[model samples]
Target: MKTNTTTVNGIDTQALLGAIEAIRNNPAEAQSKWHVTSHWKGGTRSETKVKSSQLGNQTIAKDFTIGIDEPLELCGTNQFANPQEYLMAALNACMIVGYTALTALEGIELEELRIETEGEIDIQGFLGLDPSVKPGYDHLRYTVHLKGDGTPEQFERIHRTVMATSPNYFNVANAVPLKSKLVLESPATV
Candidate 1:
């Protein structure tokens, strides 16, 4: 008997299933490492270079440079995206992936989907002027706009699943353990 190959909203479910099967067979294949190097420019301007990602024993090279800055009101040059914008972007992007993949897996074809996210930060905390203030966002609000072949109930279920499964969503929504090490640069000499 011949089986139908499925592709919904440009997502190849068969390929996704194959990857899931591969990871199931060798759980170690689920390991993924991402790397980036950032250079700080004067007055809140900086650039981060994403060079590669490591999956198991293989290194995949996909180079891209991202620039970040703050608005003049925040003492930055306002040249590129600010760190807060990037934070929301990362969270949205990760959740979108889960949304799309899950939609495809459910055999639903998507017509449109998007998420709007916003948050507030206390600068006083960052500036060390207020010891009790938190430097990061205390609460984040997001709204999802979705239209697809699936019913509203199905979409709502998928949204919940995405929230539970998205890596960056969990990272941002929870207090993840962070470790830091600092190495002072040697003074330049001519």
Candidate 2:
């Protein structure tokens, strides 16, 4: 007798298993590529579009775009989420993905999983009121509330795995170098 495989939380379990098996067979197949582009629309607002990826022999393009803006008090129209908020969201979402994927990989069915993240930022630096203050979040906090069919020890192991393996979590915890160059554009002749 055979049981039909199904998707969980929008994740294809069979495909995931297949990918894991493929990775185990050939680690080079696990490397993935991603690309995104953003254009500044005015007044602290920008539109970022998910571009494309080279998966195997296919170039898949994403059709989704995200709008980013700050609150009115932060010199924005509050039309959308701020960049810092997006950072927190990315961290939480990455952890969620890790938890979901790892649980499925371990055959642990999850009844519920929730992730929340918070960070404290001092506006003095952003407003240029204090040169000594940092303009970014000095500290960030995140909480994961999970209720699953696993024991406490199992849950602890999952937490450790998520912390160790989550990409965004690792990124936020580690410092990454930024390379930027300013390119001035001339006004249009039209």
Candidate 3:
């Protein structure tokens, strides 16, 4: 099927779809696949726990501890993934994987790929100073480093493809509709 492209928040959506299609067409050369879930725990330290479940088992878990508490250690039962850092990590990881897969499918020899992301947040929202404001990232920026044997044009195309198609990238760059649902679990009396 032919993929149609649209621009969202400065990203070329059509080119991104083409890149993903190219990668999916060649599955044998993919690098990594994983899923993650996280839950928030309200209290001091503002901690959160994230788990990675795969193949019917919880294989890995990490704690995201934030606040002014001596920089939570990532060694014991609790680790740190401070909210902002986690956001950057997600973007970096997604871009690396997406770019790698796309390059492999396009027959480009990629020696190295690195991505760095930074985000800014407003404190007013967190402190409840403004009810109309949202407590989320105000701006995000990314820098990508690529080393390969492709022309400047090819490299630019590959970069565009990765930025447009990556799920994490889309989550931050596009206007995605989100819905919240509450599920209550209770014990049944017999």
Local error of candidate 2 at 17, Å?
2.1
Q: Which digits, one per residue and each the tens of the lDDT, describe model 3 over residues 28-60?
A: 434444544444444223443334433223244
By lDDT rank, best first, the candidates go 1, 2, 3
Per-candidate local distance difference test? 0.91, 0.86, 0.64
Tell me the lDDT of candidate 2: 0.86
Provide TM-scores for the models.
0.94, 0.89, 0.59
State the TM-score for model 1: 0.94
Number of the top TM-score candidate? 1
Using TM-score as the measure, name the better of candidate 2 and candidate 3: 2
lDDT of 1 by residue, 70-128 (tens): 99998999999999999999999999999999998998777788999998888999999
Error (Å) of candidate 3 at residue 116 is 1.2
RMSD of 3: 10.8
The window of 10 residues in a row where model 1 has the poorest summed lDDT is 1-10
With candidate 1 superimposed using the best TM-score fit, by how many Å does residue 90's alpha carbon deviate from the native?
0.2
- lDDT for model 1 comes to 0.91
Which numbered prediction scores highest in lDDT against the true structure?
1
